[model samples]
Target chain A: MEQDPRDLEKAQAYWRENIRYVAILLAVWFLVSFGAGILFVDVLNGVRIGGFKLGFWFAQQGSMLVFVVLIFIYVWLMNRLDRKYQYDE
Target chain B: MDPWSVQTWTYILVAITFTLYIGIAVWSKARSTRDFYVAGGGVSPWANGMATAADWMSAASFISMAGIISFAGYDGAVYLMGWTGGYVLLALLLAPYLRKFGKFTVPDFIGDRYYSKQARLVAVACALLVSFTYVAGQMRGVGIVFSRFLEVDITSGVLIGMAIVLFYAVLGGMKGITYTQVAQYCVLICAFMIPAIFISIQMTGNPIPQWGFGSTLSDGSGMYLLDKLDGLSQELGFSAYTEGSKSRVDVLAITLALMVGTAGLPHVIIRFFTVKRVRDARKSAGLALLLIAVLYTTAPAVAVFARTNMIETVSNRPYDSMPEWFGKWEATGLIDFTDRNGDGVIQYVQDPERNELRIDRDIMVLANPEIARLPNWLVALVAAGGLAAALSTAAGLLLVISASVSHDLIKKTLRPGISEKGELRAARLSAVVAVAVAGYFGIHPPGFVAAVVALAFGLAAASFFPAIILGIFHKRMNREGAVAGMVAGVATMIFYILKFKFGVFDGGQAAAAGLTGDWWFGISPEGFGAVAMLVNFAVALVVMRFTAPPPAAVQDLVEDIRIPGGAREAGPAPH
Candidate 1:
């Protein structure tokens, strides 16, 4: 279980990058789902798209689509971070 | 088609699927305790994703969720937001690290991180309580599908479900459950989508239910489907499909509770442990969310379609000339028509004082094919799909419960000398007993099936989510803080539910009335868990500040768990 100091430093750096990515992604999640979908729904509802109020669509359909996309983005971002820090496995 | 043919089709489809599940169990039979516990950590990402989706979407999501949405209208968005939002938390905050921790169970992680058997025992109790509460709803879902589709009594239906779950779950363990769940994800998604696609095409000329939600109606008019639904809802005295009815604050609280609660659930969290690499855990979570979004997105569309179909088909129609589906459901007491004014026609309006047609929300998904005049075989397929959804979740919950009992309680704590084979046998025995208990509750369902399931999410959120997150992210979190936080969190949640939901400790009958205006800040029992979780965090932080920090070794363990390299194969821990 002995670790090289360099590997430890790399792991720490990797952890830092991972947390940064998580923070950015989660902020987007909250803004889209909670902010747009609920808190500011009325303002968005005034702007209609086809059959749905923009806010209503976000609450029911749009936020979920965004969530799926966000996860993929995290996956792609994390893979790169892993390789950068030599923790790709 | 006649009832006999429908019953025959249902029997054949269910039998084929059951046999397939058992065949998978035999094929993937566990060789060692590792295989039994975590599938030997060999599942591919996409396959694990599908299994996780199947495991997560229970009977409640498959059978009752759309029905609830159809009735609740915009308020139902709470479910849409809460259930799926938690996956974001799971992927970003918890799943990968826990997988890297390489434990057999959630309790195992808690125990090692806190370096206390007591902390593990508290988690075991919480996990069992949450899993037991959830399994009841799945069992009831099985019974509902059985009684309606197979014409069997509910008790018999539950027993049959018990036998099937017991066989596979006991024999194959996690390996069997994982493969069968992947199969179940296919059966259920197909079953769910075919009827939804049919109805969407009929109503909006859109084969994709997701698009059909926003598309214009098929009628010569260019009015959108949602616009038409709002008009219908207003005409019937119900809230508009896109408009909120509950207070915005309550909606926010409930959605947040569900989101955090979903993230904390042990059974769902356990799915991540079966994947091969830490990277796969992260990728599998994303993939699982994508698969789940397929059903989650389609559900609202199905709700809209089914609601519109019900109104047009039955509203203002004479009882004597009602559609075949209406009469069929009425025979089972799921649909009731009473013309109090002696009028021959049924008035399916929103007027509670004068409405003649009463429909149970649970029937919406189960009867959607019949309501839309879809083929008989497809109706039978929905039955099989509902069974798959219920059985997959039921088996998953049973496994978690059995593991808690046999591994966490007996071998880890009581009989440390037990051999690996003896532990595996104990796990299987515990699973059988767990199935029997779940089956009994399914037969005599504790009141509030959906509400009870919601409470399970709340408990998970309040108790485990905080503890596990702190265990990983807050290295200073000690055994005293973790254990105390769980007890306080769970106690507050249970007390709130019992007081508000069951009237426990209340002096008067009026006080016992559930979901009343008297609720604290209008927060329903289902939404109170979010508040309790906050309380848990506050208490834990304060307690930890006063107590000594965890040992340096525990801190090192936390740091090791955070890295993505070197996921150890999860096996029975060395005593």
Candidate 2:
């Protein structure tokens, strides 16, 4: 069967939301990895939690955990968007 | 340390793992071109996750990364963050879309999206360059482990490893490779974690490695492990463990290059193709990162544990009183002890002239367990684990190289009318040749093996990242724009690497050695990929504006891939 041409607008909206979600998640990605992990590392290292320097923790451990979380969050967000947009497998 | 029984443990474990792998390979051997190419387009997210992790975490990271971290201190975070952070991009930006496109290789996506044979050919070249360079290093890693631990020569070790990897990959194709990789992941992760957990509990009284590195030492000193490490490091005239010697800009650039390059890697990207649905692709990317994080996070902790354990065991100690591991490493020529002060004591201070002990950075992981005096069987397990990591990575890369030759060049470009059975045979034959070439490099590696491997990431970042991103994101991107961008990006990258890494263009070796002052924006060759990627984007955008947009059919193809719902007939995407 042919695609419903009326669904074209829906496709556009889906693409727009996908782009927005990607942009937001990538910003978080940059903030954790490049920002906390690198740029503001020295400033944050001044603060400590338990035995860990905040910046050092972010660089070695915190950023990687955040990265893993970010992907799953994207997956959850995207899957929900697919449902709302009526896109299926 | 033993010549029998426990050393016999290494033999028994290695033999059993290999036999199990062979059994798995034969059981799952590919019967069709589809199975050989994309594993029949059937893989669960969890299983694919393990396979992706195993495919990417090579022996270099398994055996050498912790050692590099021990020496580089905070600067080592470049690798820790750079390597793992790429998954964020892959999962969010690349994997699902690529899976929706539903192709066997990266070049297939590039070729179809851009709708150009030239684009496809350029991609094939880039894929070969990246995969071959990567596989050579993995082959050497396998050889080194066998020679060091199992008392075999490097050639024999590489040949034996090659035969096993070739058996599975050639016969089973991606399907065989995927299942074998999952099993390898299980074996290697257990071997890695067993030692790490033991050492963590011993040192910090914490069972978890991530917590163990940060917690206070259990020695009644009441000081955090990191704080103590910093103090000890400073006492020995080295930089504090929490501080880095690299400029922040250099670190930032290097980390970005690695992250971008990791997303662009063909073998890692292709792992997404084996999964059934777009959502599975996304979920598996997340799962892969979780599995990999288990090692990436523990690596820095292992660095701390090993460095502290090593210094306490060796520094200022009598040479005659050194442990058996030290002597064993010395015989391997990895550790050198000289009495510069004529005191017969090991002086391992950071100061060059006064230092009497020289230890290679690659020895840290292998030696860490021995220094901790863990079980002999545990040490042997590390060797087996290293082999698994190296072999898994090598096999994955070989598949990419083989597919690029057979599917992209032979089947698509040169011989489109070839039958499915003929194409499958071609793929298997190409895999054999690829392994032999990679094996030859392992035995007599080029003098510049390390440099070439480092540049593989840079070249990948420069070329493929832009082409693929623009292909999916910018439907107006035509063949002229994509081809020109790829060429410009790769040329820029090659020029930078040659001038900075090899001193080829203007500065000879002398100038290259001290070329830190000559860096463009203070970025080293290792960090140059980010700059080249920017050049690619700029060139492509400018060229696309001046050139014609792609045909209606290709634009529709782009729209179809972006949506999740159906197969190829998505009408037209609103521009």
Which residue pairs in candidate 2 collide?
Answer: none
lDDT of 1 by residue, B48-166 (tens): 99999999999989998999999988888899999999999999999999999998899999999999999999999999999999898899989989998888989889989988998
Where does candidate 2 chain B have its weakest 10-residue lDDT segment?
A: B566-575
Docking class of 1: high
DockQ of each: 0.83, 0.88
TM-score for each prediction?
0.98, 0.97
lDDT of each: 0.90, 0.90
Name the runs in model 2 displaced over 4 angstroms. A1-3, B1-6, B511-514, B567-575
| lDDT by residue (tens digit), candidate 2, A47-70 | 999889999999999999999999
Docking class of 2: high
User: What RMSD, rounded to one decimal, does every model reach?
Assistant: 1.6, 2.8
Q: Can you tell me the DockQ of model 1? A: 0.83
Local error of candidate 2 at B70, Å?
A: 0.9
**For residues A10-80, could you state the per-residue lDDT of candidate 1 as single tens digits?**
87888888889999999999998889988998899999988888998899999999999998899899889
